[model samples]
Target: MSGKRYRLQKTERLQLKIKLLVAHGSNCWWCEEPFSPDDWPTFEHVNPLSLGGTWSFENLRLTHESCNEMRANHYPISYEVK
Candidate 1:
């Protein structure tokens, strides 16, 4: 390791990252809700973190809880990236 320590624990970091990710996106990727800072939009990863993804702006997206759950463990091949 490079001797850097994490300011937040793994769980805390994941929570914070999800919050910030939704805030930065500001709307559901599918439904287009008017997201607010207080609103806890579902956290979505463009590439599954379990598959070696990282916490980056480009990898984050805003989604509804139901949508996120439905898409979990599934990847769509025909998604139109814009």
Candidate 2:
């Protein structure tokens, strides 16, 4: 597979991971606001996955698209879990 195709596959799998989390509760963990599947969510890293947060529930969170983008590659900002 081409590098681009591989990346797309990885992205799809990552999206599936996010979907599983959202299906249980399609809302922002911190803000407690519902998020539609089509609304676009951020696959937030609880402890900066690179810093070692797993793909498990405890280490993931769903947030607004913009919120996630703002946090890209940055340490998680403190947010209350509702």
Candidate 3:
């Protein structure tokens, strides 16, 4: 199990994304901006995986791809929704 990594399946990821979108709308969790046609939506972990975060729905939020990338693997101190 040391070299093996666990990842969400495509269908599972899609389901989670859809559920998050329906619950939170298309807003980026970090920036609180609605997603535009040019923006790509992605799921971000509130606690980074590097810090032992799980892929559970409660730990995930919707964000822009760019925002997620900017966040990287840092742990979030607080989530301010503007």
- The most accurate candidate by lDDT is 3
Worst 10 residues of 1 by lDDT: 1-10
Would you list the rank order by TM-score, best first? 3, 1, 2
lDDT of 3: 0.78
For each candidate, give its TM-score against the true structure.
0.52, 0.50, 0.81
TM-score of 3: 0.81
Error of 1 at 35 (Å): 4.0
Output the worst ten-in-a-row residue range by lDDT, candidate 3.
1-10
RMSD of 2: 6.0
The digit string of per-residue lDDT tens for model 3 on 13-69 reads 788788999988888888888987788689898878788887877788989887888
The positional error of residue 66 in candidate 2, measured at the CA in angstroms, is 1.2
* Top-TM-score structure, candidate number: 3
Residue lDDT tens for model 1, 25-76: 5677756675666665765667666665555656667677766776674454
Error of 2 at 65 (Å): 1.4
Model 1 misplacement above 4 A: 1-25, 36-39, 78-82
Superior by TM-score: candidate 1 or candidate 2: 1
lDDT tens digits, residue span 10-75, model 2: 676577555656565777655667777677566666666556555555556777776666565566
Candidate 2: 10-residue stretch with minimal lDDT? 1-10
**Pairs clashing within candidate 1:** none
